[model samples]
Target: MARNIAFGRIQEDMNKTSFFKILADEDLSSESMRLIPNEFWRSSECKILPPKVTLKVAWGSSWPVNLSPFMGCYLMERKGWEEFLNDNHLGDNEFLTFTNEGNNCITVDIFQKNCVEILKPLNTSSSNVKNEEMSCVDPVIAESNKRKVDSNVYGASSSSSSAATFSLTIKKSHLTLLSIPVTFAKEHMPKVRTKFVIHDPKGKPWEVVYVPSNGSKLFSSGWRFLANGYGLAVGDLCTFRLVRPKEMVLEVLHDSP
Candidate 1:
């Protein structure tokens, strides 16, 4: 069987933009959609406009649409763009990432929250505890020691290690399948596709796949089962610890209504 590469990147020639917020009234409705204000097209280095392109959603779906530079902003033309919005149920205040795939093909990823919420220290001492019994014994001391160990082993730049720990605020869609940011995954995970284990707060283990998102990959599998098994919901706060290259530990900081 062909190895299923988890994620891939768009061609370098494609024009890409940072994640941008969707205007409440303008982006979701039938009104014409405007590209986020940026030098993406305005920069002297980027002047060519592709007449036609495809829009691929990370979740799964693609649409062919026309592109036109209008009044210093790029506008998406054709009814297909509207249909894409409706199909995705995109609304105001959400976030979308756009990547032009050359040949008029653009890929998009939707984010329920405009920004990924940083994980705060649930408790300073027990913050890095990997064992339950030890954490319960002396959380303060355990946390202090963990910090020292992390400092010695992983150093100050947390990004340098294969392991990572962070928190995310759950969204409605996350209830079905949590979305891991490409930036986070790229930093802590192996480049190739693989299945990893997630240990919930209760110390139960579940298997999830780590798919890299170069440009085409969307939410693959493994996370939803974990979320549903734990009955996760929107507004909940989830803490994740990438314990090893293929193992993670999860904890629910707060459950949602």
Candidate 2:
């Protein structure tokens, strides 16, 4: 087995912006890539073949200084290739770490503008893309309906209809299989850890949840299976209504002391 190797370099040519351009324009192959720590590749004891495309790997910020064009494509694909991103790969200023466990560990610390690409092995045959749907109840309509029913007991004239009052058109392309956001209002923050509710003009509602970031801001935009089954039309209106903050109903065991 070839021993793992580590390398780093400051390449003015290898920044994030430029890397993507190279990835899109270049057709990389295993033979064209350089195996670093020169001695590791020269070792006759370990028969580690060069990485194949579609390898599953984790990339932090650092690694063998420069990544091959094939490695760059691996990152783009592994990371969902979505440009709608918010940097979330690093836990802190720590250098990006890439590891191919049982094979080799590659670490690098490029300038912030450039990122190191790590190669990971994966089975592509099993990872098929499927069309799923998303469905969730709308918060605004749920609350409004509850209030109207409550007011009826007091003989108050509840003129408000069950149908929603205000709704904005949402594009189908904006929603994913996980009910995630493709594009959303930058100003609106979904009440901390909660989903975004969409109330329709008819007072119907839908919900889209957020997947917590795992050292990476990039997320697979997906919606619930149930919701997607119900066809969504472009230009259809939806509303987001604020709900009361979720609170613990029971006291913690430690609180009694």
Compute the lDDT of residue 134 as modeled in candidate 2: 12
Model 1, 1-257: lDDT tens per residue? 00011111222223343334343564354334555344544322435766655665432235666766666766677466665665555565555556543344444645444342112222335222222222111222222223322322222233233336767898887776567766766555656666776765433567676676576333358777887887777778876765444556677756634
Worst 10 residues of 1 by lDDT: 1-10
Q: lDDT tens digits, residues 193-220, model 2?
A: 4443332222233334444442322113
Q: Report the poorest 10 consecutive residues by lDDT, candidate 2.
A: 246-255
Query: In model 2, which runs have C-alpha deviations exceeding 4 angstroms?
Result: 1-166, 177-208, 211-222, 246-257
RMSD of 2: 22.0
Each prediction's TM-score against the native?
A: 0.36, 0.21
Global lDDT of each candidate: 0.50, 0.27
Best by TM-score: 1
Best by lDDT: 1
Give the C-alpha lDDT of model 2. 0.27
